[model samples]
Target: MNHNLMDSTINEAQCLMQALQSAGFAAYLVGGAVRDLLLGRVPKDFDIATAALPDQVIAVCRSRGWSIIDKLGKNFGVTAVIVKGVTLEVATFRRECYGEDAHRPEQVWYGTSLKEDLARRDFTINAMALSLQGDIIDPFGGQQDLARQLIRTVGNPKERFQEDALRMFRACRFAAQLGFIVDEAALVALSEFHTRVRGLALERVRDEISLTLIADQPDVGLGILVHAGLILEECRIKVQGVYHPVPLLSELGDLVDVPQNPAYHVHDVWRHTLAAVQAVPPKLVLRWAALLHDVAKGRQGVRGQNQAGQPTDHGHDRQGAVLAEKMLKRLDLPARFRTRVVWLVLNHMRFHMNFNSVLDGQGLTSLKHWVREEARSGLFRTAEEMHEAFDQLAVLCAADAKATGRQFGHEHEREKFLLILADILQSMPVHSRELRLVVDDIFQEETERRLIGPCLKGLLLRVQDGMLSNERQELTVAARKWLKKHKQL
Candidate 1:
């Protein structure tokens, strides 16, 4: 490991450490920063641990013209200092005693040695420290464990977990985020200590789970949670941190082993879903959508099998949307966010249908017929522009295809179609006063309200396709035929 930290952000913390050391108090860069530095990953935050008491630490900050983070009790022995526009967190070397519930430390005592302080941490990898002179302090062999790609506790796994049960989830989170493995002892301890994991605040649990879901390899973390018997603990997570019956994702029980047809999906339902999730760039929305995209597969109530005889999650798109709505609602996500995710889930399957139907043939021909169909179809329902709608759908399809051991292809042709489509739409004045007159002349006031949404936009798309002229007479005839066909008259 290069003792010299490569990142410039560490300089702020280094200055604090040097100041503490010069003042005859033992100080070093500690926790995650040390671990990430040795791994050559630039840490987002820098923290310093020192033998200086919290009062002494506050005094040093005041003497050095740095502002304390707050009134100071918010973080126990930990304090945040802002120096030269960079925030550095400084903590005193301390030992803590946990209450029987193990949610947080009940009492804390300062003036502890660095060795004792390091021993109190959650994981071996994070227990290591780096001094101002570039020396590493890793009495628990964190460096070796890091090289081995392992997640282990500072001492007896059971004892560590007993002190802070959230450590069990943290272990899985670390495994997921860093692509590491939990040590056998830790896993066993987690299994024995599973109940303690439920004592944590549901919001905190949700936040941790959310972080794991967004990690590079969420499956690793989730698999550990399952193996450690911590999966069911999800039910104890109160809805939005305070609702009863805890609407949990754990409700999607045994989805991993759900069977799928070999022809399209060689893997089981769980594997396929996870594969889709992993295929997408780690956006929370995309990953969450991918995870729940096919959740209804193989369930007794859901429609199954397509016309082709392959196992079909026939109405899974809509079914999964319902489930997603329920789960996200229970988790207390933003209303707009939940609506969008459900919308994406509901339309995920056919978003590419219109263009795809014509892909092998006249996809670029004219948008006129499709728009007319939308105007004529009483069920026409789309928000925003068709182009943006298709864009999101295309991304969903790509993720779905990737999960099934396939690719969404015919790429070059699709690119060409989009280029042509863009040009055609740009040239059309579908919203012109001329077109407005045609609409006014054809449809009733009630019917016009509906057209203002999907119907009107649908016609605009058609006009771009050259199927309908931008002229009043041409649009009038098209509008009458559309309204009459759909019984809007």
Candidate 2:
């Protein structure tokens, strides 16, 4: 059990530990809970490893009238208990043997040895545990590995990976999530074993990559994945007449060596893309846009100079949306996310498109006029269409600009651009939610459903932007207009 009484893991937790002891079984809070605690990070949840069998653990929960989730059962040796409002996982010590399917262990047997249990774990940092009395368990030098900020297999790296190939992927994930280095031996094992993931489910692989993307330094994790041959195969590229392990879009692998206008981007497209991805706040939509924003810069890669004789990646924003669609569709990501990510990619360059004249030190057109002009031109749209999404794009653009080693042109130019951009974003209008009630009252249920979905949302946005009024007469007129435009009238 987690011995810390003050950090929300006391009371019933203590009782459970005491209960296990009273039953003549040893119980200790193990796995991630103990490791994170030792690292001075708050553990998300607590798990306990005990000498008690699955049946005994289930019995204990019943005696206390606690809820139980015993779904894992003998297959994985895991069960849960709701004790005094907190849910704790209770698992038995076991050594696993994997069959041909790497995901499922072929057979399992419970033992009283916590040492053996920790030994079977994939990583040393995760293998460490804590006793109820707070004595540190460091049988495999897990503490030493933790101190060195390394992720290493508990025993022989090759054997451990052979037991379960998924551990190789897990190694990359832990390195990314924890910002730790993979031990040299572990990295070698991963390079040799990455091909084992070829048969793994796409959803499972995608999920792990998703977690890594949102971590502190996603690009670092990505770089590690590439080095491990994890990214080459996905890229659909061949080196030495064999497939390379490229994760995500193959276009990303192409971006690695693609050149850019030296005046705008100091590094190549891939480096700049990574910088942009790292610069964003790690939101799913924004990060995806940031990573994909400049991907088409290579294809639409600067056809020629604009009228001002400056380098431009003409049509890249549009082309990127198409390419991004292909990537997301192949991955079978959520439909809602697919819609928003593609939208963000399409519009990512518009921020600079409108501000190019102002940013080039030519004119200080009044902010009010710019906002109004942009709204009328659909440069800025409804609250739902633009507000949160545009906010993300604006931040992404800032990251894009700052990716230049010298920080986006001269110091004064960068500051001025960012300030004006901020004001423009802040000045955008919001749709009147009150208009939804009006929409409902004015239209039939069937009509209301259609209107509320898109037609009304558009009307409300126009009303907020001053193109129409929120009053009943004007909203009804606008709805009729939208239906007519769609030929649904």
Candidate 3:
């Protein structure tokens, strides 16, 4: 293995190593940090593997006047140290064994050899380690795999996967994240051992899938998972519309290309969803929602006769929302994230429907009505919430439409929708500006007096609703009467 460390990372790791060695314990930079440094990527976090046990690491840190945060748990070994706000994870070199396909090594055997530790890792590229003295330890040929841009199991793929099924998904996620390819042998093993993923925890699987969705090339990762037949096996869920004959996006190879399609979508819900997921910013919750938004389109799309005998997915958004909720729940995502995702999926079709209806000037009134109704119902009342929802929804809808391969008859219709979305985004008031108002001074001024007090705030909340319900005029009259009775004027 090559052992030329990036100067900056080496300095960081050496600082920790010196601290440990001064207290008489062996320590070395290890795992992903070493791999990243070799690849010239800034490592997200640095980790040190020490021959000293977890307790010993704490003692070394305490002797150096450093605060140690023991974050270790059963079946996992870790201790964190904070130095100038940067955290470094220090773990003992240990070997693990699988008990019943759920957890590794019902008992752990701490080892003094770095080779032993590297041999027990999940992937070849992740098994390499770097020493404080700048020595590279690659008993597993991890450097070769790194050079090849391949994700290969550390040792026996079957045994490694059986030890922890989550590694299977991690392999795919790393490939996606790093733009690497899964080793052919590893891919073959993934196909045969895909069922092992069922043994992993839901949250673990959710995280890996989320990472894959946010990758620069998410489709590559998803395609590998689908080709290996591991999506259903690992996810423990079935795609609703995997077999549908949908149109394909013409500019599929282009980066961030979102073509407009109006006919039957060629990509199944899963593939279209992967494309949509790729279109959004790499936000965890938003990407997850994007990937799962149209999961029900395949199951709910009917071969019904439109005026022209074309197929339509009339209520797929509502059905897709239900499916998204179920998938999110199974993964134990936070309740708030689950709710927001389901809401986005449920309403994803609304804007597109509005676009189609309002392509002609005749439907603008109906579009406005729908927008007002949504606002009054508090579906998207706050500017921030509305912006976030619309941004994600637009991306999902555009990807869905593009995957269909049909173009809108009127080019201006699609441009109008884009214009509307841009207008919505710009219409949002900055919260900081809103917060800068001097309420006391405003209340004393006649022009701003109407904005004061809880009554006024409460009225504002209900104002739009009242107008939509045709009660605004009545409420205005009642308010004047009440003010006169109080003699405020």
- Taken over the whole model, the C-alpha lDDT of each candidate is 0.73, 0.72, 0.66
Q: Is candidate 2 or candidate 3 better by TM-score?
A: 2
Winning model by lDDT: 1
Best by TM-score: 1
Given candidate 3, what's the lDDT at residue 474? 50
Off by over 4 Å in 2: 1-12, 234-248, 300-313, 360-382, 409-489
Q: Model 2: per-residue lDDT, tens digit, 345-431?
A: 887676666556677666445444555554555533364455566566667777777776545446676567767756654544544
Quote the RMSD, in angstroms, for model 3.
7.7
- Candidate 3 wrong stretches, greater than 4 Å: 1-6, 10-12, 73-77, 234-268, 300-311, 405-489
TM-score of each: 0.80, 0.79, 0.78
**Residue lDDT tens for model 3, 231-304:** 66533333484322211111112212222123555554455666666776677766776676655543524223
Model 2: which ten-residue window has the lowest total lDDT?
Answer: 1-10
**Global Cα lDDT for candidate 2:** 0.72
